[model samples]
Target: MKKLLSIKNIIISIAALLLVWEILFLCSSYSKALFPSPLMAFYALIEMIRSGTLLSNIGTSMYRFAAGYFSAVAAAVILGLILGRLPKVFQYINPVVQLLRPISPTAWMPFVVLLFGIGDIPAIVIIFIAAFFPVLLSTVSAVGNIDPIYLKVAKNFEISGSAATWKVIFPAVFPQIANGIHLALGTAWIFLVAGEMVGAQSGLGYQIIDARNNIRADILLATIFVIGVIGILLDSLLKSAEKRILKLWGLK
Candidate 1:
């Protein structure tokens, strides 16, 4: 029943969006070429799919996203785990993290491009930078705040060293770390497109640029819609995975 309700809600939301879009298109004075109706964008989306442009760009974007995001999260979580055990060390490192965290990933595009050149690497680097700090900070904070009773239980069981950290601390703090991972996923995905727009020759972001240069507003809008839909799908997938993991660990 809940799943059915969720599906119904999604359908209604999408229908409402289309209605609003059509209303705006009808009311606007702008030419159809400049501000396309939902139907026009839908047709454009079909054309791109038929041409295999959408799939190819999606594959490329996903490849970069997976490479960068997973690597960043792994590195950050590992470091966070280590630093989290050392509050004194983390205290010193937190200042530097705070300083860098506020800077937009795109702000480093020129420098990233200069170092890595125009290709997948720059986008990957941008995603890494975008995802790194959030997970790191969250993991560290979570670890530091783990319940003393959990550690006491581990000690009572003679769990020590890596075993204690992994079996006890890691699972205990995972609920919090998961929050960071969730946050990073969105940040990384957004930066991936932004990075691709400037540094990549191909991908969804570049498709927008390509469409704009050709004055194909329909295709541009279609690409934007596709990006948004993909983002939603990714977020949903992550949420499901998080739920499953928590269930497995009996943490949910």
Candidate 2:
């Protein structure tokens, strides 16, 4: 059963989809210009490769994604630790965070575009918005929920003052932080395309928009395929990294 659902299965599924797409393309009177088959899409992908646009676009998106994602993780983790330890501080920030968290990243596109002026900065800023909250809230919750018994034990060990936090609080917060980071990673990745599409001259999002405008369904399909694949790859990489951290921390 595992083998049945393995990489081979993915290939088979894609092959079946292509077969259906080709059959539909053949039967329909729709112009090829409107709806190209899978083969045409594959061909267009090759053309994109030859034109040197594919790698450049993909690289730009990945770079923007990395910047935003890393910024979110750094800010969230540090803030999460501080707020989790001091609920009073959390209270101070809570109202503003609550207000901002509900605002959609896409809704901020116009403002971001105006502030950053049609560039990578706007897209990067958007990604940061989309990712930071989940990790922040999760870390706060995790810290608050740390076992009281453990705190008592740390006190018994005379591990008081700031030393207590690094030794006890941070480790206790790890499981929650891990989960939050993983969730944030996926969320940020999804938002990359939407945020990037605003006025991007090049990137995966731009590639999709360009394809659509040109009526190159094959190119559009290929761009979608690339984006989906990249999302999956990034998600899997983060999950593996989290599991490794858990193992190293003896929490696995």
Candidate 3:
């Protein structure tokens, strides 16, 4: 009953917001093309849905996102584990990482476009770049900051090499690494959209561009709203995955 009430309240709040928006739209002197009402945006969303353009763009964007994000996670975690285990290697690489870390992934758009041309390649590369450092740094920190007593325990048990790294260290640092993944996913999504907007011919980002070019403010606004909804869904999915992992590790 309480949960139902909570959901009801949320719906009411959203409805109120839309009502206010409609009222403002009616009162405002601005052109509907420039500032579309919620109803107009909804109709636009329906049109896109009916035509299958929205689903196609969403699928394309998700494909690029999943490919790049998973690749980044794999590469970053592997490299982070190696570096975390060997301080000397990390020390040598730290300077270069620090230098590159501050640069925005979007700033690489021109270079990637020039090198890879306008397509999925540049978008995926941008997502990878955006996601890589966060996961790497988080993993490295998590692994490096593990307690000395854990290592002592592993040594006493004679769990050496790959066994020690996998069984002992990986489990200990996984929670922190999961947190990094969450953060990286959000950053990757943002970069993916921006990359798609600039380079890709077909995506949610391209839809936004197409809307703007065609002077369809309703479509643009609807796409932006859909982006937010998709982002929330992606975050929820990652959190669910993290929870499952933590549960398996008995850390939850």
TM values, all candidates? 0.96, 0.90, 0.94
Model 3 TM-score relative to the real fold: 0.94
After superposition, candidate 2 runs with Cα above 4 Å error = 1-5, 27-29, 158-162
**Global Cα lDDT for candidate 1:** 0.95
What tens digits encode model 3's per-residue C-alpha lDDT throughout 144-244? 99988889999999998889888899888988899899999999999989999998999999999999999999999999989988998999898898899
Q: For candidate 2, write residues 16-84 as lDDT tens digits.
A: 988998899999999888888888888988999999899999899999999999999889888887888
Best by TM-score: 1
lDDT of 3: 0.94
Q: Considering summed lDDT, which 10 consecutive residues are worst modelled in model 1? A: 160-169
RMSD of each: 1.3, 2.1, 1.7
lDDT of each: 0.95, 0.87, 0.94
Residue 72 CA displacement from its true place in model 2, Å: 0.5
List of clashing residue pairs for candidate 1: none
